[model samples]
Target: MPTIVHEFDWPDRIVVGTVGQPGARTFYLQVRGGRRVVSAALEKEQSAILAEKIDEILDELMAGEGNPFSIQATTPVELVDNEPLEMPVDEQFRTGAIGLGWDPATAQVVIEAYPLVVVDEADIELSEDGDGVEAIVVEPEEMLLVRMPVGTARAFAKRTREIVGAGRPLCPRCGDPMDPEGHDCVFPEA
Candidate 1:
């Protein structure tokens, strides 16, 4: 497992962005605080899941009491460095376990990313009585953590959804992503 190189409790900025064009894009989660900045490469699906989970957590929080999710639209969330990531991002590991929660006391959303660890059926064990043993998954070293106010999280969720959704739409014929040059459709109309 790659060690958690860095962890920021309250990053100055956390945002998701793409490097390439729609069809040929590379999604990245970047965090910045003061003079330090770290960017990790992740798959598009991971980006989508991250955004979805964040929204779900925020929605659940708003379900109770007054609407605490009403964040302003013009929240300041500027990306510190806009320069494209160096030729090859070193630690481009697929994201593993992600944790999200709303801290009512601190009034900030907590987001964490762990190194993705694949578990196999053989890894699971059974108890002495043949009853399935509860498999315990220890939390891996966190890739990064962001404890930001509601507005920051809201802006992040909104921008993430937009960035992930900005990809090319699926092709009608083959159900595959269509490129600007057009994809070869297998199910050509007869």
Candidate 2:
């Protein structure tokens, strides 16, 4: 199948948001502008990793020989998600591999996400689909590509980090995430 690429060279608004409860939350990356909008769903881990990588890229740029990371504008440094999802909230795909890079000439950061394919051992035990005739098939993979200014990329990284950390707090005892009700931590302290 041909690869489906969604490109947003300079989106008016690009943001990451989570829906549902903390532990069961769903992460979405949305870009809006030019009569087009794309939203991709991804695991929380992927989101966190993406944010970390972006941060690393910025750090490297800042430490470059002459510091070539000077793509700044009047855009707000903080992330604002006031804009609602571009209706329907249709997820393009479940992100598998994420890629990022900096274009010096354009001073823009390129972000890419590939669809993920999941396998299950229980599939071998299944006889047929609910129709009792056709079998389940994997969905075609799609990729999302977005190019934005360095400053905007920085804001995205910061906001992503914040969102990922905004989940349940750590239980100082077991070094695990704590629930609101309580935890069954055996070792309350070391």
Candidate 3:
């Protein structure tokens, strides 16, 4: 678990912090240059929980009523992937905060830690030849296949499904999901 300071303005300060085990998540908050900030990210559906924990930890941090710092391993939080990470609420908002370029407010705000950065394997899709993307999968950074037996494969698939879900739609042209179909897109599909 890394030490973090909430980057929020006045009255806001370091609230809580968490670290993840293998395939888990890490969270934290801190204060630097007189700003409070929260730092974390879950699949998407887990934002609220992380936000809640940040609030809770803020309460605890304020208990001392001085330069504050509070840290703890969160109670397994369910992430948007529908899998439980030993952190607080499953927060997918972490990605929204970071990936979507949603910066912490410079004025009146909440603060906490979020983990959005990850070293992911290259993703492979079925391409334009498949039936609406037979599958979208991720393997280790440079690996080509899973080296597991049937039973392990089943278990892994189950867990992955629990984590990745059916899969989120993407922008056909930009290769990102900015809007659903039927809606106008800045970058139209060719």
- The candidate maximizing lDDT is 2
Deviation from native of the Cα of residue 97 in model 3, angstroms: 22
How far off is residue 52 in model 1, in Å? 2.2
Stretches off by above 4 angstroms in model 2 are 71-88, 119-140
Consecutive 10-residue window with the lowest summed lDDT within model 3: 141-150
- On TM-score, the leading prediction is 2
lDDT of residue 148 for candidate 3: 21
Model 2 clash pairs are: none
Ranking by TM-score: 2, 1, 3
lDDT of each: 0.71, 0.77, 0.33
lDDT of each residue in 30-101, candidate 3, tens digit only: 222332223333343443344444334434534655523332223223311222333333432343232111
In order, what is each prediction's RMSD in angstroms?
4.4, 7.9, 20.7
Q: List the candidates' TM-scores in order.
A: 0.71, 0.79, 0.20
Off by over 4 Å in 1: 1-5, 68-93, 118-142
